[model samples]
Target chain A: MTLLQRLAGSARREPRGTLRVVDPNPLNWLYITYNTVEEPVRVTRRGKVRPAAMSSYRWRGSRTMEIRVRPGGRFADGTSLDACSVHRSFTEQTRWHSPHPPGTHFNIDPRTRAEVVDERTVRLHLPEPDGLVLGKLRATHVMSERFWRDLGFGYARDETGEGHW
Target chain B: MIDAPGPWASGPFTLVEGRSIISTEPVVTDGEDRTWLQTEDRSPTVRLRANPHYWDRVRGPRVREVEFRNDVDRRRALDLVCDTVGEVDIVTEVPHREAERVRRSRHARLVAVDSVRALAGAIDRGVDGLPLDDVRARRALNLAVDRSALVRDLFGGHARPLAGLTPPTPLTALHRAPGRLRPYPYDPSRAARLWQAAGGGSRPLRLAAMTDWEAVAHAVAAQWHTVLGLAVEVRILRSDEEQREARRRQAAKEPRDWDVLLLEQGSQSADVPPLELHRAFVGRSGEFRAGPVDPKFERLFDHLRSRRSQLWQVLAANRLDRYVTDQALALFLVAPRVLYAVNERVDFQPYATTFELADTSVRRGHWSLR
Candidate 1:
């Protein structure tokens, strides 16, 4: 299995495993590992961005993409994950400065709204047609709207200091 | 958010930050019997301990705990890691001189990858009294240094001499099609002529660089002093805030202190090359420090924004690369290869660049001790 698959599987099977790693401090670990809860449209490995939570996504034209979420997804909070939640997560991402650097956004600022076509379908709207949309999309992670509204913009830590969706 | 302290983490492991250092602990308790603990020693040494909570998927960091030491001195670091008592598992940032020795040694494994960033110097045309206001002087400065020799001696032949902004990597080479690119040749006599024409004979030049890159400052200072017979002194910027302030001062067309500044630009794949250019050269906040602006280059970037074809986009980027080089906006320098050393006992896979691992590569948790 790929390291990511193993990590995601580990997160599912056991929320705690002592896996020691040398920290490179390159990208945010939150977005990089453990994709069982909130997953990005794609994850990069060895320079290639591979699809993950998103089954298939394509640009409608230059500035918009029709995104299809994998069926039967659930947030760790036991809340059903849907297209509206994905749209809300990304819209929240652009509002405040994300932990990611400015150039990381590639000027693909999602404004106005991402149309929730259906329960499993989302249409992302970009400011303009950006050539870098694919790479930037790889960095955008979905967050639970319930968590974002109740606890705060970031992940909530349980009593044990464990992060919850 | 720009002001957010940390990104909401959703991973198998969670970071435990200490007063001075940060450590990671697994969040998912699989009833595994293994643990991972780390403590920092203020400087470079990081002590790793096997937690009883750690569940090992891979075998053996045989020693109960391993110490990782960081030393700028390559030979000394190698010696410590090779020692039985020290038991240093890894050495970060080894110097180029010890690459051969580290490669041959059985104690430590040498880890070197081409640095995604390049070290280059930019001349400030906005400096009130500096002769660099003339494009010829900037061109003269670019021609004076022998980048090939600098790469050979300073980098131990482990870097590629960049003529333009983009290094010819598998991804960046797309922006550097053959025949369209030209780097300033090392020609001191012609440089001398340009200097004389620009009336810059014996003028004192101040070069500013990052404090972390003192070695780069000295190397550039030495090259300019020896090659062009110009008096050059290097100044180190204490922090990023200071660097930004200086860039802002230059962007606002305010008088600047130094004539040349050593700057670094990195490309981590995707369509980032154009964005980098837009940040450094085109916008109102663009910080090249050179007061001059080119309308033609700005037009090219606008063209870059509208184009969708990979072939056409790369062609436009290459044109921008050529335009920037010909203007002597920044003298292209060699992209140094990143170097690391790990003990022979450990199983590790190092990455080409650090930023690439932020989302995908597993640098931790999966590595096993042999």
Candidate 2:
């Protein structure tokens, strides 16, 4: 299959199929093909957010959310996806510079921390009570630890001319 | 221009290096070659192959490889898609003017979907000596134009009259109750009466718009001129630089040259939730706001943002939508449908938000290598 874009412009510098997923460019179409993440919630066709990667989630308190990941998920690199990986991905995403506008930055807020409670559970500690936290987590993508080690941050191309995560 | 490599993240198709190529010419190849053809002026084409390690093996990517090409001219893009030989499988956007042509093409099919996008006029209420400062006058402006006629005549019935800032999508319908939130009916007499009550004079309103919105601006100007007997000068911003400068001026509240700015709203993905759409349009720091912020709207928005319950937030959003319409913050126009030209051979399903080909496949017997 072949796709055509009407406009001609420079490709974005942000690595494709990563945590930074706010912009709706053609590159975004490739996000699902390359990255794996337990979206805390998925927006339905009618625009309602329902549980996706996570089997279930609930608010522990005003600023804390306990999420239970669905079992049997794996990254493209063949690594098992669990609570610790989710915590690491969320933490790393917070530290990365976001190219999107502040309002559209859906990654866990920088002040928020991700805590792994068990193998399948992760707790998100937001700085303030947010009604849209689950919706916000939809933009966050989880990559294998090996991906971070190999690609590090930002756009990286090895001698083979392949993009890093 | 870095190419996507394989196996970094988990998608259905990994970026196949070497086999994946970018070229200016329409070269269809499944050979493993490291050919990267790029020219100074032409947009490059990209190709991707399916991932063997894809988790859902049963469903399958189905196709072995996919290619993407960028066409600088939309007309040419449409032409290629409608070609009898099927040079291209799908084209992302078909210009509204050429939608009819695509519809008539035997080799191509026109996929028109309801877009979240809306075309509206941002009134500069802070501009002194204008009746737009008055909410009744603003409402009068919205009421004066015939949105239905605009859709029929201008869009060829390819659009829906916008009742508020957001388009009438299923998501938006959840908040806006029927009859409670409806578009201001076309009533030129009522508009004239309101304008007269607001002490509106013969001051010629200056309307600024981009090249794309020139037609709508002119039609709106004509309507205002005929209905309220108000002369409107439509200034066309031809270049991106000029549009950027106009936006900067609008933001700084400097150079009060234009009383209204005719522009498109929701250029972002159509899948955006109604709450986020509201934040993007009327929030204190909204990107599309061209005039002075309203304190009432600010308070309402702040409340909506602070709420923790989804139900409360939805209700608040409904209230906010109603408030913006009632206050007539902007002249709501039509929600145009997104158009796509797809080759007959491609089994493509258009996404409401973005142009996606991930789930798309070719009909078994119909698709053949050129």
Candidate 3:
């Protein structure tokens, strides 16, 4: 609701629902919606969302920062957020993780992701909820940690050009 | 629907009397009163006044010269109507706010008939069948599309938008929530899992789409990278070639041939199994790719083959919505609407669905110049 409240929200967790969950503010709402390997493939989320769920760090709620990364290359479920995962999101998707560098016009807060509780469960957390905030998230980007590492920290000078950022 | 327009040289008065386009001034003498028609013109504007030398159907009076001036600027023209420039009538291209303004004006009456058209999630071309075997991946793709923006921008808050392919037509049966509607509007992490579950991973998806809609295709490709972590290859082809390729993939009935196609075809035009089947299932030779199906889509397909009633078709369309959205054939974007504004006196019927050619025939004779 206010600047102070928004900053305070990042220190909290998120909630889930059955059938469907219309997220009020999905941008910073750190959460996950996964399916159980079990039959019916019912949607599941983190047992308890944590504000600092798995983020390596955080910004002052509004300013963008740079998260320097290197390549781990290989990616699979258990693949650590290495050079490869981070690189792809950067080079391929033209994004970064954790604190995205300056001029990052669009990106999912790289500092965002869920820690796997098991083969099925993944927890979530968020910064805050606002109509304008989440509404703008409709046009943001989400890249894996591996993508950033591979890309290092290159930024797109001109998005119109078809080149690696 | 048809484009037979002119100052209608054959109607009344002659264009020879006017000097410029969008701005025409004509002198009219009805024995009781005289008025001059002067205004800027553009956007399908032409005026029709009393025909003096001609003879035609009469509302009350018989013969006089009709002035047809193009008041392409809706506001100024509408203002003239509000001010009543001596029976200066017929204004098409009336703004949304002025839709009521003209109605309230003493100079003219409004003939409104919800002519707004919604152009939501339309596939540029229709495919014959499900391109992928994975229903989850299909749902993921549908969810990745931005339907709310379309609802907000296209309809101007005048209509309800659905996130299903078949939308909420009377014929629709299956319905699903717009999972992941906003915030992270296009979820690639979830999409990756769905793709993997649907027999993918390792390599990126080659999302197929026409080149004309480059932005939409790019958005899909970017989302694929995040969700499925796949390198999506967007391809563009001519409309006819695109149709040929898409139908071939749909008809091939093989998942290996095509992964996904971000289409833009008219979604809510018609509802019937025969119509859909002819296009998606039992399509023309070499026009489909999603190969054979279970007894379900087949049975449903068969039921749609018959000519159903309008009410039946509406219900069927709603049912088809579930099939397409769930089956991943189409994700309802927005129930898009077309936008246009005309002068105040232009009481011609507005047709958002069909071509807006009759916007030309808004003459004083047919137009009630109140």
- Please name the candidate that would achieve the greatest TM-score relative to the true structure: 2
Native-referenced TM-scores of chain A, all candidate models: 0.67, 0.67, 0.23
- Residues B264-298, candidate 2: write the lDDT tens digits: 75533323344445554555455445566678887
- Which candidate gets the maximum DockQ versus the true structure? 1
lDDT winner between candidates 1 and 3: 1
Q: Candidate 3 lDDT, tens digit per residue, B237-339? A: 5565565545444434333334555443321122232232223322222122233334455455444433223454445444544455456544444433323
Better of 1 and 3 by TM-score: 1
Name model 2 segments beyond 4 Å from true: A1-52, A96-98, A101-108, A150-165, B1-6, B17-43, B52-62, B248-257, B267-274, B307-309
Which candidate model has the greater DockQ, 2 or 3? 2
Residue A68, model 1: Cα distance from true site in angstroms: 3.9
Taking all chains together, each candidate's TM-score versus the true structure is 0.71, 0.80, 0.38
Residues B159-213 of candidate 1: C-alpha lDDT, one tens digit per residue: 7787677655556666776555756888989988887788874557998887656
lDDT of 3 at B339: 30
Ranking by lDDT: 2, 1, 3
Task: List the global CA lDDT of all models.
Answer: 0.53, 0.62, 0.33
